[model samples]
Target: MTFSLATWNINSVRLREALVLKLLDQECPDVLCLQECKSPVDKMPLEAFAAAGYNHVVARGQKGYNGVAILSKIPMQEAGSHDFASLGHARHIAGKLENGATIHNFYVPAGGDVADRKVNEKFGQKLDYLTEMRDWFRDNRPEKSILVGDLNIAPREDDVWDHKKLLKVVSHTPIEVAHFAETQAAGGWVDVTRQDIPDGRLYSWWSYRAKDWDGADKGRRLDHIWASSDISQSAHSSRVLRSVRGWEKPSDHAPVFASFDL
Candidate 1:
């Protein structure tokens, strides 16, 4: 079977339900994983999404805060989820498709403006979260799985608009990148997006603070799609919908896409 999937940090799925619907209408990927849903599962617009032809969903959410979800046109079952750092935040969700492939959707903490954990509790929490994630993958190696989310870190130098300038920034710091690498190694995950587009200034997020976001073109590849080596070669057609950032009242992030021929 061949299916397409997309990952997006909708920021607040409730607030951007229309945008989600718009995306479903424009480029109907077979599965779409969303992060930062910012609403309780009961409050999510599942009815609306179902009406858009995505009938299956697995999600974990909270009121006005962190959340993650996976909506699919194909049959799926809720696999499970983890609290990672035990932060009790709704940051992860998983689903198993009929093809026996699992999908993990996550919304890792942004780590805050300060990279130092000394005075930054959120930064410390972010680090702890990743450490737990690495351990989980190390203990239970994944196969025939695809993981997608707003991981909130840019691991590659080309992932940022200006890597040197952003080295000290929260998302591109050396410590965070190292944690990211270790986690990737633990899972034996192949970056689907990077595998397709090996080089260039590829990015999926731009700050809302930019006065002329497109013109300035300052952005980061904070969102990702990763597949375990067993199914990595089945993945292709990866791309980021950069134009979505220009949508009316859009999220700072753009949707990233990939197709699997498993």
Candidate 2:
């Protein structure tokens, strides 16, 4: 079966609940993976989603902090969850389908302001998180898998609007890029978005601090969908819903989507 899967960092699930419904009504992705939900499992407004025909749900959540969830129209089984860097953050969750394809939804920490880990604990933790992820994947390689989330680091120069201008920026710093690349390599994953839209300044996130976000358009492609090499060849119709970024009370990050036939 062919189905569309999408990932978005909704910022605060509670705040964007309405917008989420709107997107579901419009896009109708079979599976929607969400990051930065910022609500506990019980606190998540799942009833509305169920009403919208998205009954299958699984998530790892913490109150007022990082969270991730997968809402699907098709039934799913809980695959697993992980604590990257042992940070005790609700950042990773997985789901498995009847077809045996596993989906890992992640919310990698957004390392603090400074790039130097010595001066920034969050930055250090972020690097450690990536390291652990690489080691984990290297040891227990995944197959027929689709990974999606606000990975928080824009690894490619073309991923940012102005790479030179954002060289020292938190998300685009060399260290973050290198670490993310290493993890991807170890995981044997292919960047589905870039695989389809190979040569362009593609972005999924724009800072809310920008007075005129569209006018500035200084955005980064921090959100992504990666597939294991085995299933990467099956990925088709990849896209980023940039229009959702302009929606009413929208999340800073837009939804990244891809359709697959396995």
Candidate 3:
């Protein structure tokens, strides 16, 4: 079967429920993974998603903070959650689909403005998180898996509009980039989006700071869709829905999507 999967950092699922529903209608992805949902599992508006034909959901959430979720039209098994940095953030969730493929949804810490641990605790946590993630993948050695979410690091120079200018930026700093690369290599995960549109400027997020965000287009590829090497050949037709970022009251992130023949 050929099915589509999408990952979006909705910021807050409750606040963006309407937009989520609209995306369901528009994108028609078979499975949708969300990050930064910012609401407890009990508070999630399940009916809205169910009405949109997504009957299965597994999520990790907390009040006004980090969260991740997977919604599927097909039945799913609650695979698990993870605590990477021991920071107690609700940032990871996983599910196994009826098709026998596993999906991991994550929201990596943004690592604040300063890239130094002495002055920035969040930055330190981010590095620790990446280290733990790398070790976990090394141990588990997942196959037929799709790893996705707002990884919060732009690992490639082409991923950021102004890589040199953003060298001091939290997401594009050399340390974070190295750590992120290590995590990716540890899992042997093929960055699905990059595989489809390699060697070019690509972005899934744009800061709201710009007056004409679309015009200025100083964006970063913080969000990602990576798949295990075993299933990499089945992955295809990936794209970032930049139009969603233009929607009224939209989240800073746009959805990244891919199709796979399983």
Error of 3 at 50 (Å): 0.5
- Model 1 clash pairs are none
Clashes of 1: 0
The lDDT for every candidate, in the order shown, is: 0.97, 0.94, 0.95
The residue-by-residue lDDT of candidate 2 on 1-262, one tens digit each, is 8889999999999989999999999999999999999999999999999999999999999999899999999889999998989999999999998788999999999999999998999999999999999999999899999999999999888999989998998999988889899899998999999899999899999999998998899999999999999999899899999999999888999999999998
Worst 10 residues of 3 by lDDT: 194-203
lDDT of 3 at 62: 98
- Tell me the spans in candidate 3 whose CA falls farther than 4 Å from its real position: none
**Local error of candidate 2 at 118, Å?**
0.7
Expressed as tens digits, the lDDT of each residue in 1-262 for candidate 3 is 8889999999999999999999999989999999999999999888899989999999998999898999999899999899998999999999999889999999999999998999999999999999999999999998999999999999999999998899999999999999999999999999999899887899999998887899999999999999999999899999999999999999999999999999
lDDT of 3: 0.95
1-262 per-residue lDDT for model 1 (tens digits): 9999999999999999999999999999999999999999999999999999999999999999999999999999999999999899999999999999999999999999999999999999999999999999999999999999999999999999999999999999999999999999999999999999999989999999998999999999999999999999999999999999999999999999999998
Candidate number of the best lDDT:
1
- Clashing residue pairs, candidate 3? none
TM-score of decoy 1: 0.99
Q: What is the Å distance of residue 221 in model 3 from its true position? A: 0.4
Off by over 4 Å in 1: none
